[model samples]
Target: MARGMGRWRVLANVAFAAGVLALAGFGVFQVANRRWQVQPTFHVRAQFPNVVGVEPGHRVRFQGIDAGVVAKVVPPGRPGDPVELVLRIDESLRRLVREDATARIVVEGMIGARVVDLKPGEPDAPAVADGALIRSEPAADLADLMRRAGESLREFDATATEARAGLEHLAALAADVRDGKGSLGKLIRDDDVYDNLVALTRRGEKAVEKLDDDLMAVKQTWPISRYFESRAYYERDKVLYRPGSHRESRTLTAEELFEPGRAILTPVGRTRLDEVGRWSKASGRSRSEIVIAAFTEPGPEPELDEALTQEQADAVRKYLIDRHGVDSAGWFRKRKIAAVGFGAEPPRFEDETAQAPSRRVDIILFTPQA
Candidate 1:
């Protein structure tokens, strides 16, 4: 009976072992096939300027999310070249990349883990195929990074040195100002300029006050002001209490009374049409245009030849033949004559007036170099 129990126990143990083995196999298969196993994996390469801190098994990310891992990092198919990073991209995030996706090495935070980050070019890009490698942007190394920081520190030291020099210079300037050395020093230490400025301000204030009083006195003298002064109204151009030269009539428009020579009917003078007829023809412009042109002028340039004389003016033919340059290109020279017309002066008001003297000059052809 004991032997039979022993045989039965052996068979039970064998069956239990087989069942455990089957369950373990099923569990492994479930883990492998689940969680996006069909998703896909893509590979890429990266180059680090230096690889002292980089190693295999480093996580690859996009933005901040985990998307892949570094599989292998080796020299670029040869010796003494940028090392390549072979990435095994996750199936879910692999679709985010395109053929033009860029790979770059990044550190998470200050003194953080180093990883490769892929920027999947544009948003609606096509997914990259398998086994293809994207370009890896060269990354700065630890030494290079430290060197950048050291350069910044050195610059800061230089700036401090400059600032110290500026302060010393300013202090010396202050000492000079106290000693009354230069113009600025004189302004600080002397009292003559301050006295002059104060006196000028007082004069200006007195002049302004006098001008205000004069304006008020003149306002009381006009006919419009006379009505206000008397506080009474009178008939139009009649019922006059007084008549004098101060109240004499004058012309404000062209048809009104004018000087003897300025009347439109006068001969041997600039007729009214001469001022107004420019638009009628193309010779001269209206007085209004002449005034506007006077204001809209480029400032004067220095005289080209101070020593140009009657000899030069008469020798225009000779200079053009000798010194004057020939226009090979024959580009047309557009010349304009500009001058200031200070309105007619005393002579213009008389019936018999002399011609206005023209303050103008003629040009000579001068070249810059021989």
Candidate 2:
């Protein structure tokens, strides 16, 4: 009985060991193949309103190489909110985390793996912190894409309308060109108008040539015949020209008007300047006298103060000649003794420089002895 018990016990121990070995093998294999073999990585979140081809166990990659896996999909906030995707990235790539780096769900392979490809930020930037969230810029949603498409259609419609208007205007312009309406039309379609203009220009040139010839002929005959006749007629009878020419000449002086010291005016010698001024003005120009021709013995006329004796007249002339110069030669006019005028003053003209109670002047008229 003891021997039999020992055999059984040995067999039992071997069986138990085998069972333990199997369990240990299973536990080690579980840790290696599915648990410990997978790297522990931090969760990064991405929000999506729509994730068409993404699911848990979907491959995550940087470029094309596998780097991580999609771990969970949860609401961005509440249960009904837009979903946020979480990823588990291999720890070996932890150094690659950076703030500007992004994770995108990308189409991969021929079958197209739904992937989270991490784009590394510039190396100069700071690394991403633990449990950090990554922002997702997703493909356009259906409504937004449709709205953009509608906007594009409206823009295309507006462009087409403008193009149609331009084409219509061009067609009208082309018609105008055919019909010879505008300046451009005239340029394109109306050679007759241009020809008429050219012909008119030629005619004008010929007319100008004829006019020049006529002018030359007129010029050739002008100086000797026509001009001389015109000049004689203008100079002779035109009294207005005489005074104009006299005025244009330099003023004549008193000496220049007479030869040597002899005066040109009789008034300066026989009478005062005032006496000559009275001839036309103060006293009348017409003179009358009652001459007594002796019909009987020479008798004194009533108007004469008794004809003075020659000696008496000589005596009177001598006294007068001493003070007021006498006309002893008697080369002056005899005058009626109505009124006598003496020295005169200058005539008044408009004064450019005026004064109060302005300066005075005297005027006089007189008769001269004959």
Candidate 3:
């Protein structure tokens, strides 16, 4: 019976050992399978000039979302060759990875770990094929940046030292000037120089007064007097009438007003004319004139273009008069309506293009100075 007990004990020990081994194996399987829960991954390759802090198993992010991981990293064969990385991205986000997508190494936080960032391409771009190579921008090296900052600080220190020396020399020169040791000091301190300057200024004032009297005499004399009067009249006219000239200039493209190569007003043209008529009535300017000017682009036959532009301007004027009752019998009895057309003449403004603005119409309100 004791021999039997010994054999049972041995069997019990083997059973316990087997159970422990099974449990350990299951735990490992669970851990391994957890990594691959987001299944059906697609692989892509990227070549970076520097992957200083990047390593395998580093996270891959697409537009800030965690998408995949770095699968492998291959060091460059030569000094100038780029380091190659194999990335396994989730198949579900395959659409986001396009042919034009760019990959770059980026840091997670301030002086933190590094990861691979993938920028998705335009929405209209085609999806990137599996296992295709994608472009990479190199990661910035922290150590290199720190080194450059140190060098800049050293340079600034040297510049500051030089500036200090220059300021010291300037201060010494200023001290010498204040002590009357230079020509500039003598000019500043001498009473004789001050008296001479005052006398010269008085003589200059007398000479200016005499010149002004001579000009006035010339302006009052015969033929020259007429010239001065004409100049004064012109200046007065400019001052009085400049603000009233082209007080309101509304430019309308030919396409907006009329059919192509036709003088008839379109529906849109009639709508715009209605707005202008309402504005004119609201303005209450009974003495103002309406001037309609039309322009055409240069054509093979200049005469035809001129005639077409004239017809267009006349059509607009007729529309405003007949449809809107802008006539010569009402409050606008004395107001004149004029239509002018320019064929192939460049606009006064150089910024005007040959496209729409050249083929245009301008409606201007001309108010004479009261």
Candidate 4:
């Protein structure tokens, strides 16, 4: 009876060990097959130019959901041939992945594992068949990204070095200027230079004034005056039967007539007034009247505002009379010239803004009846 009991105990132990080994083998088979935990899947192939960080057993995801696993990674046999990846995707989700579905390797997390990501194709498109090749986008590796970043940093360093060199050059130039080492430095440091410039400007002005007076005097001399008189008579006869009174007007912006916030005329203003001079010479009217009307927008100071407008009008009239030889004597005895200032007056246009066109000067010329 003891011998029979020992044999039965040994058999029982052997059966238990066999059962454990079978269970372990089944677990291994399930893990290797992968279909034991989910529905059956279909195999699909994808070719990629590069498959960095991708290998067999990597999880495959469809729209971020766990869908399959990479079964195999086949390296290219030829230099130009692409690396092939075999994927096992769930059959149920197969319809969502069409022939145009793209497969790309992606990083899972910050410096974590990588996975295969499947992007679904158009809904109306036909589904990809089993063993069909899906398109793949090559994954950019961390090493490549680091290399590019290094290149960019090198370029930025070069630029920074150049900027530093430029700043050094500028500092040296500024030091030279401060030490009165250059012509500009001398101009800044020397008061005599400023005084000389002022004296020269005054002399130039006097010379120009004298030249203008001499020219006017020559125009009014015997022979020249007779020629002008004859031209005037001829013009008058030609216009005898036409409308007797002639009027001309010009509108100028405040900026075109005077400096900002000052009645003094800028060089630009003088140049523009030269056009009026030319027009006055061409008019050839002996008995004419010029009305210089200056207007300004409302300002904080009423008296100063009016004074500015008056000064602007006066400046225009004086420029015409003094520089353009619009004399009020001899042939111009009947000529009437006036300057009028309309201070802080609203513009005639209903939609006029506060600035610009509202601040203007109007010059009007009227020729009397023949």
Model 2: worst 10 consecutive residues (lDDT sum): 288-297
Q: What is the C-alpha lDDT of each candidate?
A: 0.46, 0.45, 0.71, 0.71
lDDT string, candidate 2, 135-244, tens digits: 67674343454445434433443454455565556556666666778988777756665555446555655655565454435433523223322211211112112221
**What count of clashes does model 1 give?**
0
Stretch of 10 with least lDDT, candidate 1: 288-297
TM-score to native of every candidate shown: 0.40, 0.34, 0.42, 0.44
Tens-digit lDDT track of model 4 for 97-138: 999999998888855599999999889889999999988888
Candidate 2: TM-score? Answer: 0.34
Whole-model lDDT, candidate 2?
0.45
After superposition, which runs of candidate 2 have C-alpha atoms over 4 Å from their true positions? 1-42, 48-53, 79-82, 106-114, 125-130, 150-154, 161-165, 181-370
Weakest lDDT window of 10 consecutive positions for candidate 3: 231-240
Better of 2 and 4 by lDDT: 4
- The per-residue C-alpha lDDT of model 4 at residue 273 equals 88
Clashes of 3: 0
TM-score of 1: 0.40
Q: After superposition, how far is residue 341 of candidate 3 from its true place, in Å?
A: 82
Q: Which stretches of candidate 1 lie over 4 Å from their true place?
A: 1-40, 47-50, 179-370
Clashing pairs in model 4, backbone N/Cα/C closer than 3 A: none
